[model samples]
Target chain A: MTSVQIEVFLQTLIAGLLLGGLYALIGLGMTLIMGVMKIINLAHGELMMVGMYIAYWMFVLFNIDPYLSVFIATPALFFLGIAIQKFLVNPVLKVESILPENQVILTVGIGMVLANLATVFFKSDYRSTPVAYATNAFYLSDFWETSPIELSLSVPWTVSFVFAVVITITLWFFLAKTDTGKSIRATAQDLEAAFLMGVNVKLMRVITFGIGAGLVGAAGCLFLPIYYLFPSLGGQFTLIAFVITILGGLGSTIGAIIGGLVLGVFESMTATYIGMGWAPVGRFVIFVVCLIFLPGGVASLLKRKKFGK
Target chain B: MKKFAPFIILTILAVIPLTGLSTYMLHILILVIMWSAIGMSWNLLGGYCGQVSFGHAAYFGVGAYTAGILYSKLGLSPWWGVPLSIVVVSVFSLVLGFIVLRLRGPFFALATLASGEVMRITTENLVDLTGGAMGILIQKRTWVDKTWYFYIILLIAASTFILVRKLMESKLGYYFVAIREDQDAAESLGINTTLYKTLALCISGVLTGIAGAFYTNYMGYIDPHVAFALHDISIITIMIVMVGGVATYWGPFVGALIMVLLAEVIRSMPGLGTAHQTLFGVLLIVIIIFLPNGIVGDYKKLKRLLGFRRAST
Candidate 1:
């Protein structure tokens, strides 16, 4: 490849890597919920939208930075998650229906209400948090005067990436160390087994759901400065999260992280090479391809390797 | 009364145009019939077969576009789309079923949903064939009066109702119910679950596609948004089945009437129009929690509750 071609490729890769880290954050919540509850949270993106709205209002009213609003939004989302689980989902779980997909349909309804209500109250406007350093960037040429090519890193993307890493590490530490976290994992492995082992499966389900909501809420806050938001944006992000969960092997956290990176890079590549409109198609191409060839997702491959079967 | 109820209702609907009702009312009736037709098609797959699809719009859009293409590109009448879509939608459904039928429950639902969205996006990008985002507009409409359109849709809806009823009474219907009750057991009983599931998907998809082709001719407009709508076409189809009653012959009809009337009433209210989806969402939640089997499915329970209330009062 020519110098310009190589530079373009490198630029796209860097941009994709930054985007992927954030995507992983979004996917993490969905994977966690699917793991513990054994139900896909179709309203995952709407919950993220709520978190973004909260951050937007905090920035507008209280003059707080988007990053700092994470602290506020996360806990609020945790409570919201608890309420939804207690009032809406738990009841449906007990309801006898021909179709076992009632919970999924219920989530779709919740998403519709959330999206429509936002449009009603917020007037369907595209919004963003206007941080002071929105355009602040670090240039490769500045750091290395003898550099052959130019590169710029936006301040917000880098900051978001770092925050995502830190949060993921914290999640790892908690899940690996804490008793509640262990119980949650145990429940995910085998619900009946966990119950037999004297773990409070009901409580763990609620807490896992809350943590999922809280984590995605933090992800929304991280995304606020870099991306624009509207109420309907949740639907697309919901698809993105769903795709990631599938790619990552249903409820596997590590798989979700890898799937997020793969999707992010692939999406950006299509946006750069193909026209922008075809990017969504690329996302689905990856999804359909994964479904057909690797139905068990990346986690299955990991399992195969570990088991040496 | 129960035995002759369908014929009586069909006769009443057939004669409604002669009543000199206003054009607006005729339009509403047309919509109600069309939606019920779509709902019945959905019910065939979702209710009896237990394969809930969230992307009937994919078939719907493809059907609309088929007719639209015939009129605009082939210089043929839009009516050709109705017959041709049977062949077209069956092929598409077979392909779609091959991929989606592998997954069960919510995964299947999600896969279908994505397929609808993918078709929309593909159509939007295929500007030459689909006219891009501008969509297709038939310069001439089939008729200026609403009566012909009403009768045509009514005919379609009636046939659909009959087809579903006949299918349900046959051995095929028993197979579907068995698969729904337990796939593993059905497989053990030598019922090729995959073949039956694929058959159900094709029938349901073809039926919805026919309705869509009818929609294109009736509306004289075909856009990716209107034809392949997720919330509007797909969700509403599911909602009809959900509200009316799953797996019941008359549920789709009842649900369609209520939903259509509800939409019209809500849309007429200037303030409540934007909040319609919120109401829909709340209704869905309440039904899932309280009714679970929809109005027709749980009407006995509903009536008992009402009777108890009357006794108390």
Candidate 2:
């Protein structure tokens, strides 16, 4: 390949990796919720949208940085998640319905309300946080003096990627070392056993939902500086998170991380090789292939390798 | 009395146009019947078979596009789409069922949702075949009057009601309910769960496609967004079944009437137009929590909630 081609490839790879970090964070929230609740939260993307709006308003009204708003939005979403679980989802769980997919449908209703409310309040306008450093980028040529190929990285993208990594590390530590986290994991593994062992499985479900919401909320804040925001944007992200969870294997954090990166790279490649409009199609293609060939997802592969060893 | 109830309702609906209702009211009535047809089809799979699809829009859109393509490309009458859609959507559903039927519960729902989106995206991109996002418009509508359109939809809805009722009373219906109740147990009892599930999907998909074909002809327009709308077509289909009654013959009909009227009322209000989805969402949440089985399925609960008491024993 020509030097220009190489440069383009490298640039795409960098962009994909940066985007993957945030995707992993989004997938992590969904997998966690699915593990504990045993139901897919269709409103997961709308919750993130709510977080983005909070960040957007904070930036517009108070000149607060989007990064700082993460601290504010995450907790807000945590409470919102708790309330939804306690009131809307909890009541439906007790009701006897012909279709056991009632909780999933309820989440869809929640998503519709959230998306519609945003449209009403925000007028369906696309907004973005215009940080002073939004356009600032570091050129590889400037640093290498005589580099063979040119490469540039956007400041906001790198910052978001770094923040995503830091947050993921913190989450890992909390899950591994914390008592409540262990209880949550135990409940996810076996609800009956957890309950029998005196774990508050119900409380764990609620808290897991909250944490899932909060994680996605943080992701929304991180994405704000780099991506444009709109009310209808939630549906696409919800699909993305779902695709990641399926590819990563349901409820597997490591699988989600690997799945996110693979998806990001694949999507970036499709955008580059095919047309921009086909990126979403690429996502579904991966999803269908995963379902057909790798039903257990990346986690199953990991499990198989571990067993083989 | 219960057996005659359907015939009585059909007779009443048939004579409504003769009553000389206003065109606007006729339009609403047509929509209610059309939605009921769609809801009944959904109920066949979701309510009885227990496969809650979040992507009925895939079949709906395909059925619509089948008609649109016939009219625009083949220079044929769009009405032919109504019958042709059964063939097209059956094959489509069979293929779709092969992939998605393996999944149970929420996974199946999401897979179907993805398929619907994929169809929409494909339709939008394939400009030559589908006219892309520009949409297909039947320049000369078959009829400017609402009477014929209303009659056609009513016919479709009535037939759908009969078909669903018949299916539910047959052996296939028993198998569907059995699968819904427990897949493993059904399999152990010698029921081919996949085959039955696919059968349900095919029947449901074909019925929905017919409604979609009718929509294209009645509305004289077809677009990716209008045909394959996730919230509007797919979710509303679910809501119609959920709010009316799941696994009940009259559920979709009642749900359609209520939802159609509610939509009209909400849309008519000037300030509340943008918040219609919020109302729909709230209504769905409330129905799921309180009724669960829907208005018709939980009739006694609904009556009791309204403070109706049984006569003293």
By lDDT, the best candidate is 2
RMSD of each: 1.1, 1.7
Where does model 2 exceed 4 Å of error?
A: B308-313
lDDT for model 1 comes to: 0.93
Kindly list the per-residue Cα lDDT of model 1 for residues A22-141, writing each as its tens digit: 889889999999999988888999999999999999999999999999999999999989888889999999999888888999999998999999999998999998899999999999
Question: How is the predicted docking of candidate 2 categorized under the CAPRI scheme?
Answer: high
Best candidate (score: DockQ):
2
- For model 1, the stretches where C-alpha displacement exceeds 4 angstroms are none
B80-156, model 1: which lDDT tens digit per residue? 99999999999999999999999888888888888998999999999999899999998898789999999999999
**Local accuracy of candidate 2 as per-residue lDDT tens digits, A39-121:** 99999999999999999999999999999999999999999999989988888888887889999999999999999999999
Interface CA RMSD, all predictions: 0.7, 0.6
lDDT, candidate 2, B1-313, per-residue tens: 9879988988898999999999999999999999999999999999999999999999999999999999999999999999999999999999999989989999999999999999999999999999999999999999989999998999898888889989999999999999999999999999999999999999999999999999999999989999999999999999999999999999999999999999999999999999999999999999999899999999999988876445332
